[model samples]
Structure formats: structure tokens, C-alpha cells
Target: MNADRARGAGAVRSPSTATFLSFLWPGLGQWYLGRNRLALVYGLPVVAVALAALWQLNGGLADLAIQLFAPSFSLTVLVLIVLLGVWRLISMADAFTAAPLRTKSSRRPTTLFAVLALLAVIGHAAAGFYAWSFYQAGSKMFVAGLGGDFNSVAPGASGSGTSGDLVAKPGATPATADSRINILLTGVDSSVGRNHALNDTIIVASVDPKSRHVVMLSFPRDIAGFPLWNGGTFSGKINSLMTYAGLHKDQFPDGPLPSLIKELGYLLGVPIHYYAAVDLDGFRTLIDKVGGIDINNPRAIDDPDYGGWTDGRPLGFSLSAGVHHLDGQSALAYARSRKGNGDNDFTRARRQQQLLVALARKLTDPSMLTRLPDLLAAASQTVRTNFPADRLSEMLSLSRQVKDDAIQKYVLGPPYALRSTDATTYSLKLDLAKLSALSIKLFGADSRYAANAPASPSKSP
Candidate 1:
């Protein structure tokens, strides 16, 4: 009888101890109970999952976190997280069952097991929520079929057509499939009182993936008297092109934004593969989300007539020359203010570029992990892009390899564009000859003008 009682005591101890061990790690309790084969079955899968996660994080956590903004990847992670939680729970239960049963009534062991299970559930639920948030943000930011052929639909086509209906027209340059990638970045000025959104900022970022070199071309909003893709000339400010095209869809069949993108690509003599349009208000919000940005002001800015578009008030902006930390409102003013002494669209474009680099640097910092949720939310509201989400990881990796010195910035002002008053209002007339030469210098064989000129090898400056 004593021997049986001793065995019963040992059995009761095994259940409580083994259950606690499994709670710490899947299959740990089975290992403790000498179930070696069963332990490997439970533990090896967990180990494999962990290893796979590390492998996928090849660019580190910062890059992986950014990749979550890809809807497909985020959704996959969500499913994996649920499966991982279930696997953990099953491992714990299996461990408890493999242990000897208790003879006496004891509540402590059951209570401990229940508490651990609750924690596992809560942890997985939180992870799933974050994954879902990323998926939602990506869906809002990346528009499907927005990267279609530039001049697919004919002028005067039905406005009811969708982006997917766009097909490449003959002789149209197919989106570049070589070492170079070109993306058009535009900042739209939109607010409650405005009837149309004006693309106040238009910049084309051309990157050479192999060389890790980037060229930024900034087109002034005042650029007018320029040739359009349809063999017509535009007399109004380039900033108003999108709105103009939308209202005159009979003349621009592919809709407003696409029309503007196509025109710019034609002008630049390169195939612009993607576009990202950011609302000015959303730009401010994004800057704030990153805790603002630091910029080196080469000259002082004091705009007396500055109507604070970001602040929604009449607060003018003033800043001294030198390094300065700016909040969202101030950064917007710095990028948008043209009424200041010696300030014009050209200078504003330069400042905008400075802000862009600063923001990119801030976002890639590891410290951004804590602020990711808010950042993603701001991005969803503030920006729209046709850039492929699946390629985000590749871009993120490439961005890290690119250094500041390898980036060349150009503003199509002064020598590149002559100020003309021939029109009713002052405008900038594009010097196409000069621009074509510049294009050939930058893009080499990729430039449309390359057929006539000897293609010069593009070198990093």
C-alpha cells in the first residue's frame, strides 16, 4: 500500500511540473518527462519557424517592418501568427496529457496552466492586430493597376473606363525593364475650400539600382509654354495640369493624374514607371509622425504674405539661416513659402528636396519601430502610390546602399528654363534643347534623344 501511495505522489508531481515546463517553451515538459521523440516533434517545428523568421529578416527588423506595408506579406504574417498561437497551445496540452495523472485534488496546477494559456492568447492577438493594421494601410496607399502604360487610352475616350482597361499604345515606351527605375513624386495642394487639387510639387526620382546612384529632377510649378504629349502647348501653370486635364477629359482620356504623368515623362524623355502623389496636409502629418525633421537653411526665410496652408491660418513663416529643427507646420512653410525675400519656386523646390532626404533618413532609423503604427496610419491618409508593394523590400535594401554623395539634384530653373512674359502672365519657357542634352547626359541610352546623339556614359557625381 505504501509503494502504491509513493507512486501516486510521484505521478501527481509529474503533472504539475511538466505542465509548468511546457508553459515556458513548447515541448519542454515532454522533454522533462523523458518523452524524447515527442519532445522533438513539438519543439523542432517551433525552432524551424523561428529560424525562418530570422532568414526573412535579411535586411534587419527595420526593413522587415517596412515590408509589412505590403498587403500580401502582411496577410501572410497574420495567418502565420494565428497558426503559431495554435501550435503553442497544442504543444502545452500535449505535454500535460503525456504526464502521469494526479490522484489527489489540486487546483494550483490547473490554475497555472490556464494563466499561461491566457497570456499566449493575448500575445498572439496583439500581433495579429498589428499585422491587420499594416494590411489596411498598404491597401489604401497602393492603388492597383495605377502603373499601367502612360498613353494607353486615346483622347476623348469614355471617362468611365478603369485603370485596368489601359493598354499600351504602339510606339509608346514600355515601362523600363532595365537597371534604371523612374518614379514621379508630386505634392498635391488640397483643402476644404479648394475646388481642385493642384500638384504644387513635381519631382522625378531616377535611380540606378546597379550603381546605387539617384538623380532627382525638380520641375517648377510655374513651368508653362511647354509642349504636351499630344503635340499641343500648355499656357497655364504646370501645377494646374491635373485639374485641367480632369475637367477636359474629352482632350485627356486617361484621366487627370495619368495625363500629367504621361506629359512629364514625354518632357523628360524617359519612361516614368511609377508615381506617388502626396496631399500637402498629409505631408505635414507625416512629418509630425516622424517627430519633425532637421534641415540646414542656406538662407533666411521671412514670408510676410504666407497663408499657412498647413496650419489653416494666416500665420506667416520666418526662420534664420543655419541648422534648424522644424515641426510639420514650419517644414511645410519652408517647402511652400515663395513670398520671402529672394525666395521663388526654384528655391522652394530645393528646400522640398532637402525635406525629402531628411524624412527618409528619419524613417529608416531603428527607433521608428515604436512609432510604426502611427506612421503607417499617416502614410495611408497622406500618400497614394502606384509603386509595387511587393518590391518594397528590394527598394528598402537599395535605399540603404545609396549614399548622399551619389545623389545628384537638379532644379529646371535659370539656364534650363528661361523666364518668359510672352503669355498674359509670367511663366517659365522650357529650353527643350538644353533639357534634351541634360537628359542624354543623365540617362545615356535610356533618353529618347539618344538615337541622334552619341550616348554618353552616365557617371555618379
Candidate 2:
């Protein structure tokens, strides 16, 4: 107490002590001011979350934030930070001017403030723990890879010092840094609401470690090609194979992806070893989490009934020819759009390939490294495959080695594919001969492919 309070019958107290307490801790000043309940509510969560975050930076909580399915709290943090600063300022002001507080024990609820403080700590700690766990899981997923092996005649030589029976090729082999590997990246529309598995995009990616080349083979969704998978032929476009296999996932435990890859291998005459399938929902979310991409999407005509104009309403989608940066929704439209001005499914496939190229290019930019964790996490959520973590690293290296324009896209439509004039339309036939040669040249010789059929030219859409 000040001298004024000591000598006089009634004296006002200085608020400096209250200000000091508030400065030391957000709610401490409020507590000293006799607002115990409010102090607890403000102080505890901040301390707990801060401590927990420091402890588990790479655990479940991080994973949750980074995953495509999880919510992003960056904006939330920014807002909370602003509130914290303002709250501190208010506490300091109230403390400086308020009377030296001395409340009777009966005047305030002690237990409630303590309880609130404890609860805040627990809640924030739990959030931190979850974030840590999320980051841990997400990191693992980020480094994961997909792979495939085929019944091929082992190459003539072994890799360096032989550990066992290893195959060697003239230039590089699939296992070697110099060899080549071909994989199919498929985007399937198989959400719960859709009630169907539609192959939205098909891309054949060839990775050549020797020449440091990455090539793309694109297949259109609507091209009239009889589906070829499981060593059998079905009606309609190649994109419809997933629906057929969805009904049979139980019969074939490995999933329709492998079967579909095998069929595409037959169509392209390439030794397809690995495949990756991603859902559109996760893909979009993934893009959103990373702040989006800039892809030049161009078009001329606007189609009112593009993609069958769902529910008899036009898609209201139109774009004049130009370059632009895209957010999640825009990127999704860029990848899925093939209605008004594009050149059918083959053209659409090429456009999809363009998006992939753009992503690959942007991934290496220095500005993107900060978002790497989130990017990989999103990719893992959207994608599933047999490729391993090491192979993914190799791919990163491959991306750096190859330039954008160097990656040539192979499309299946008119020449390598033929129209089947059966009672049921939409039957496109593969000219096995040309595909066989191209496959061998790109992927090397595999018994499964064996350069089958008569030589023919590739079809163009």
C-alpha cells in the first residue's frame, strides 16, 4: 500500500502493480485485478499450445494439418495472433489505472478460473499432440514411392558388382540410375456421391535415368476405344475400366489399377511396371493447401453442354486463350475441362499432361521449398501407388534433369487406335504392332509385352 493509504481513512490504490502483473503474463494482471475467471480463460491455451508445439513438431498434429483431408489453420493463427496482441494491450491499460485490487475470497470464484486454466492447457496440448502426429505421418507419406516388376527376360549384364542375378541393358536398366521406367498416372472419379468409378485422366509417364528424359503418354476419356484390361476386351472408352473393376475388387485383390495398367501396357506396347491412381477430391484439396498453381489454360469456344451438362444446366465455364495462375477449383477445371474448344479426349489428356508438367516445374522453385511438407502430404493423400520413397527421390532428381518442352506426349486416338464398327459404338481398337515397337524402345523388352502384333502407325485423335 502507498503512504496515502497507510495514513488516511480512505485512499485510492495505484494501478502500476496491476500493469506490471499483466505485462508479465496475459491473464495474471486480470487475476490481480480480481477478474480471475477471465484471466484463466486467456492465459492457459497459449502456454499449453506453445509448449506442446515445441515438443512434438513432427507428430500427428502436424500430419493432420498437412494432410489433404485436414483443415488449414494458417489464417486462424494470423487472426489469433492479432487478438493476443490487442488483449495484452487492454490488460496493460486496465492494470495501470485500476485500483490496487483486494477482493474478499467470497467475492470471486477461485475454482472456476483454475478449472478453466487447466482445461485450456489440456485442450491446446491435445491440439499440439495431434499436429505433431499428423506431421510425422505426413512426412512418411511424402517420401513414399510406387513400383512394379514384370516377367521380363533379365538383361544381359548385372548392376556394378553383382549381389545376385541382376539384369543389365545396353544403356541403362530400370534398376540402374541410367535405365528407364514407365508408369501410368491415372486420375479416377470415384467419390461416394458419384456412385461410379470413372477414369477421368490417363497419363503414361516414362522416366529415363540414362538420358534424363521424362515422356508422357496421354489417353482421352471419351475416345471410342473398347476397354482392354484383364487380357479381355469390353465396350466403351478405356476410362470406363474402373467401374467394371470396382464391381470386382473382391475377385482381384490387387485392385483394378494393376489390371488397368496391364491393359494400357498392351495398348501402348510398353512394359508397364508401376501405376498411381489419385482421386479428384484429394487432388483439389492438395492443390488448395499449397496455395495453388499458375497454369496457362486457353480455349476458344464455350460449350453449353460440356461433359453432358449435368442436370440439364450448362456448366457456365468459358475461357479465352491466355495464361493464368490457378487456385484449387480453377486447377480442377483446367484438368477436367474438355467440353467446348479442346480436341476431344486426346486433347484433354494432353492438357492434363500440361498441368502435370507445370506442377513438376513449380515444385523445384526455391519459394516452394517452405511448402514442401504440405505439398508432399497432400500428394500422399491424393495418390496411392507401388512406387517407393527412394524412387520418388529419383523422380525428383529426374524432374530436375529433364526440361519441360523435352517431355513429348503420346496420345491414343485415331492412328494407333481404330474405330470398331460394331452394333455398339465407342469401340476403339489398338494397333498392337506400332505400340509394341514403341514400348520396347521406351521401356525395354519384357516378356509380358514381347513386342506383340503386326507393325502399325499410332492413331491421332
Candidate 3:
């Protein structure tokens, strides 16, 4: 009787204990049950997957997070997460089955296994949810055809008649790695009282991947007297171009946004590859989601005549000169207020750049991880971009490597753009020659004026 009891005690293995072990790691429970081959079968694939994921994440989590914006990658991750959940549940169940069916109580082991399976499902479901969110956001953000025909004749291709007579150039390819990338960034002011959306803020972000350099060129909404893409000249406010073109599609077949992009690209002397447009009202939501941003005021601002529009602050904006933390509404006012003393579109443009940098800093803060979901949701509603989703990870990584000093900011004000007026209107006029020189300096041979550039002085023998 004593020998038989000893054998029984030695053979007994709690099914609950084996299940819990597998819950910690696939195959661990099988190993506990002495099923060595089964343990290898369950664990090796997981180990291999982990290593592969780490290899893909060599650029780190930030790069991975950005890559997740690509719909294909996000969907792949969602599938892997689902498969992982299934594998975990299967491993746990296999462990439970292989273990000796003996325990202090059968009810407790069954309950524990059920709870572990439930947890695995919940965890993976949450991961899948976030992945789905990223997929949806990316789908909306990286839309194609938003910028119109990229191969279209840029306003004044020598033989091209006039801006109104432009034609698409067939078989043109997208920007290559050797080329500079120019993205048009615009802020649309579409308030409740406004009849039409006005792209009041226009900035072109030019990036050279080889040099890892970036330049932001801001165009005042009131810029006028600029040469049109065709050989003709425009005499109205630049901001009105998009709306006018949209209304007169018979003349500008590319539609409103694309027409505006092409003209801007022509003026900048570079091919604008992408565009990002943000609604001012939704912009506020984005700012709030990432928390408020901080900016140093160069001078005190007191714009008593400033109308807050739909922002609900009708008393006008006032701020003392110094470093100030601004919430969404105040930041909007800071970027929009033109009635302040010594304030105009030029200063407003600078402030807008300042706010942009600040917002970027805030979004990259480690603490913002907890707010990522909300931030992404806000961004989906507030912003639309046609930038390639696949290249986002590279851009995100490069953006982190770039320091504040390396970024060049220009407002196209003063020397670059002169204020002009007639009996009926006041506008800012572009200094074409100076702009061409600046473009050559920024883009070298990539500049449209490169062919016309003066030859270098000959070297003495």
C-alpha cells in the first residue's frame, strides 16, 4: 500500500499548473508535461517571429509606429496579433490536455484555464483595435490624386502656351531619391460664417533627403502680381487662385487644389510632389490632443481689432512679449492676428512656423505615447496629406535626426516680397530674380533656373 501511494503521488501533475506555465510562454506548459517535441513545435515559431520583429524594428519603436501608418503593414500586424492569440490559447489547451488530470479540485483548474484564455483574447483584441485605427487613418491621409496630374506641364514649359492652355505631359515618373521633395502645406479657414474655404496660410516644405536638410517657405495670402504657370501674370491675391480655378474648371482642368499646387511649384522653381492641408478649426483639436505648445513671443501682441471668427473669442487676442504657453485657441489667434501693433502677415507667418515647431516637439515627447490614439484621431479629422505612406518611417527617422538650427524658415516677406498697392487694392509682389537666386542656392541643379545659371569663373593654370 505504501509503495503504490508513492507512485500515485509522483505521477500526479496539476493541469492548472501546466496551463499557467504555458500562459507565461508557448511550449513552457508542454515542457512541464515532458512533451519535448511538442514544446519545440510551439515555441520555435514564436521565437523566430520575435527575432524577425526586432530586426524590423532596428530603427526603433518610433520608426515602427510610423510604419504602422502604411495600411499593408498595419493589416499584417493585425493578422499576426490574431494568430499569436490563437497560438497562445492552443498551447495552453494542449498543456492542459497533456498534464495528468489530477488536482486538489478540477473546478479550479478549469476556471484558471478559462481566465487565461480570456486574457489572451482581450490583449490581442486591444492590439488589433489600435492597428485598425492606424490603417484607417493612413488610408485617409495618403490618398492618391489629391495633388492632380504630377506630369502636367508646369505653367511655363517653354512651348506651353499660357497657364490657361497647359497640357499634361505623359509618362512622367514620381520624384526620385536624387530629386528634392517639395510639399505644399496649407491651412484652410472654413468657418461657419464663411461661404467658401479660404486657404489663408500657405507654406511649402522643401526637403533634400541626401543632405537631410529642410526649408520652409511661407507665402502671404495677399501675394499678388506673380507670374502664372502659363506665360501670363496674375494680379489678384494668391489665396484666391484655388477657389477661382475650382469655379472655372473649364480653364483649369486640374481642379482647385492641384491648380494651386502647380502654380506654387512653378513659382518656387521646383516640382512640388505632395501637399498637406489642415482645417483651422480641426487644427485646434489636433493642438489640444497633443497638449498645448510653447512659443517665445518676440514682441507683445495687442490686436483689439482682431475678430476671432468661429473661435468664440471676440474680444481680440492680447499677449505680452516673453515665453508663453498657448492652448489651441490662443495659438490660432497668435498665428492669425494681423491687427496688432507692428503685426502683419509677415509676423503672423513667422509665428505660424514657431507654432509648427513647438507642436512637433510636443508630439514627439515620450509622455505623449499615452495620448497617441487621441492625437491620431484628431489628426485624421484635422489634416489630409498625399505623402507616400511607405516613406513615412524614413521621414520620421530623418526628422528626429534634424536639429532646430539646420531647418531654414522663410516668410517671403520684405526683401523677398515687396508690398504693393493700387487705388483699389494692396498686395505683396514677388521679386522673381531674387527668388530664382534663392532657389538656386537651395536646390543647385534641381532649380528650374539652373540652365540659365551663370557659368563659374575659369581657374588660372
Candidate 4:
């Protein structure tokens, strides 16, 4: 039964059948053609690679996809992919060159090839379509935030028109001709059921382009009476500067952001080169895209007012004083919570600055290469920045040079800013003398020396 049946089976198998089977699995066609030894030789390597890939993506399909594109496994994965392609080609060739079937066949080999070709075309077409769609959507979102769409009349047209062009105005001058660049990073809390959104987190970062040294100064949102671009000063909370200017667009013809940047420059006594605003919701997405952020919570944060998606029920959030890996929502709460721990706005401001540092640490990680797409998508939706896209290389260079210990953080509280009671609200009054001294120490030095200075970093207050 063994040798007789084997001979008869080999006689009946066709080359087309062999090719189709090999197309499905590297050695499957050989096995189908009654060549057991050759099938193992061809399929084992491919099967091993597939198994290794599955192992690497043990977390899930989503996790596997992220790992595939990540920087760590990029080279190895690429090599494996090339090997697999070659193996598949060999498999198909072996199948098609095999002996033709002797017995009557149920389906023609050409019919099978046609079906495979159609499937391959459909798969590639679908992939290409999605890729193009993703690219277009991302481009539109980036342009929308990078610069206003400008719904006014196009150059010569009399009627109102919409332009897709991204016209980013030149940001303010670098503090010292590229020696240092300063940017205003504002976090806005604009959620559902709220008519007005407040710039709750305001941080001014001065980065040394050459050394990649960075100094971040966090200003409390409640600091009032800050001067605006126009003659009038921001009478209420300093955080309201942008919102007020936005409301009074007549006084601020260039738009609220420009006016706010100019005023902030005046207040800080340092030229702010650019501004990047992220919606509070965007912060969550950004954090998640980077696989979350790691932060050392110096003090426990417990906020009774921590609003969440839970219907009408407050998220009585709390974080212990220790190193914690926080997801987007938890990180947001950590950065925004101001109650239940006897912490004031100043504490929250410090936490916000710390969160930024943590985010920077996460982004500079070599593993983030695979996460770039998700991050870019999140940024397009949640962030609006005047920072030029063409200058991204320079930014990346600076970011690479930024050392964790070299980041100097200053929160305007206590000696730098005094708490004052205003009606029912508590506001901060800037101590001009102290703020000037801090600014000079952080930003007034020469770029080269400022970057390499051996001064010990100050701990966050």
C-alpha cells in the first residue's frame, strides 16, 4: 500500500496544483506534489519567521503593528521581510516547474492563478487607497492648525473664498540670533459644555540650539494685569490674555495668538520665537501615542474637581507620591489637578512643567520612531503651533542634545510671585525684581556658556 499508493499519488499531482499550494505556503506546493522532504526544506524557514513575528507581537495585533515599525526592530524585521519575499518566489517557481497532474482535475491551474492575481491586486489597491487617505487627512489637519485656512477673499477675487495654502507668518526672532530659541507652550482646557476655554498651562521654554540646553519657566494662569499688545493691560487673569484678545479681534487685527505672543514677550522681557498650543484633550492623545509618560510625583495629587467622562460623577482622582507611569488620562489629571492635597495653582503649574519634561524624555526615546505616525496624527488634531515644519531638523538636533539633568525649570511661585485675594478668586502678583533675576540667570547668558554651564540644576518647587 505504501510504495504503490505513493507512486499513483505522485502521478496524479499537477504542476499548477504544486504552484498554487506553494503560493499559499513556501513549501506547501512541494508537499502537495508528493515531495515531502522538499516541502519541509522550503517551508520551515518561512514558518519559523512567521512564528518569531507572532512572538514579537505577543501583546496583540495593534502592539505587533507598533513593534513592526518601531526603531528597535526595524533592521531585523526588514531583513526578515526580504528573506520571506525571496522564499515565496522560490516556492512559486518550484511549484510551477513540478510535473503535471495525470488524473482528472477539478479546477484548472490558470483559474487559480487568476484568482490569486485578482486578490493581490485588490489587497494592494486597498492598502494604497488607505495610505493616500491617511496622508491627505493628516496634511489637511496639519495645515488647518499650522496656519488659519483664511476664509477671506482670495487675492483678487471679490467674493469670500477659502484657501488651502498654509501661510505661516515668521515667528518672533530667536533670543540671540540662533544661540537660543524661546517658545510659548500653552495648554488650553476647552471641553464640552464650556463656552470659554482657559489657557490653564502656560510655559515659556528657552532652548539653546547649539547645545540643546533648555530652561522652562512656568507662569501661573491666575497672574493678572499683564500688559497686552494694545495699550490696555490684561485686567483679569493673565491666562485670559489670549481669550480676551480673541474676543476683541478689532483691537488685535493680526489674531489672538500673535497678540498674546507679543504680550507674553513683553511680560517675560524675552522675545518668544514661536508658540505651540495643545488642547487638553490633545495632551491625552499625545501621551498615549508615545506609550504614556513616566513622571516622579513629588507629592500626592488628589483632586475632588477632577472632571471625567463619567456621567455627572466626579473622578475623585489621586496619585501617590512616587514614580508612576501614567496613561493619557492619568497624566492629564496629574498635570491639572489642584485640589484635595492642599496644593494651590502654583503646585499645579509645577506639575505641568514636570509633565512637559517627562513628555520630552519619552519623545527623545529611540523607540518612538515606530510611534511617529500616531503621534503626528494626534498632533494634527490637538496642536496648533507657529513652529515651522521645514525647521524640524534643527528642532530634532536640539532635542537630541537635551540632557535630562540640564533642563532648568522655574515655576513662578512664592519668592517669585505673591498670592493675592481678588474678590472670590486667588491671583498671583509677579514680583518683578525676582522674576528679572531668574530670567537673567536662565536666558541672559551667552549661548555657548549657558548650554555647558556646570551649575547644578534647581529642584522644582
TM-score list, all predictions: 0.88, 0.58, 0.88, 0.64
Question: How does candidate 4 score on lDDT?
Answer: 0.64
lDDT of each: 0.78, 0.55, 0.76, 0.64
Name the 10 consecutive residues with the lowest summed lDDT in model 1.
Answer: 151-160
Candidate 4 off by > 4 Å: 1-141, 144-170, 173-178, 309-314, 369-374, 421-424, 445-461
Scored by lDDT, the top model is 1
TM-score of 4: 0.64
lDDT of 1 by residue, 151-262 (tens): 2221111122233222212113335433688888888777668776778889999889877899999999989978887868988889888778777878876667677777
Worst 10 residues of 2 by lDDT: 149-158
Query: Would you give me the overall lDDT of model 2?
Result: 0.55
Number of the candidate with higher TM-score, 2 or 4 = 4
What tens-digit string does per-residue lDDT give for candidate 4 at 1-461? 55324743644666676777777788988777677778899999988887886786564443443333222244455455556656776777777666464555544466666565455446445444434433432333323221322211011111211222122122644545466777888887777776877788889897876556788888888887554544665678877766676677677555555655666666666666676677888788889899998889898777777776323445678888999999988888888778766888888888898998889767766687566566756755676554544354446556766777878887887898787655367778777666655655665543222333346522222
Where is the poorest 10-residue window by lDDT in model 3? 152-161
Candidate 1 vs candidate 2: the TM-score winner is 1
The reply for model 2, stretches above 4 Å from the true place, is 1-173, 223-231, 248-254, 298-301, 306-314, 372-377, 440-461
How much is 277 displaced in model 3, in angstroms? 1.3
For every model shown, the clashing-pair count is 0, 41, 2, 1
**Which residue pairs show backbone clashes in model 3?**
155-229, 163-230
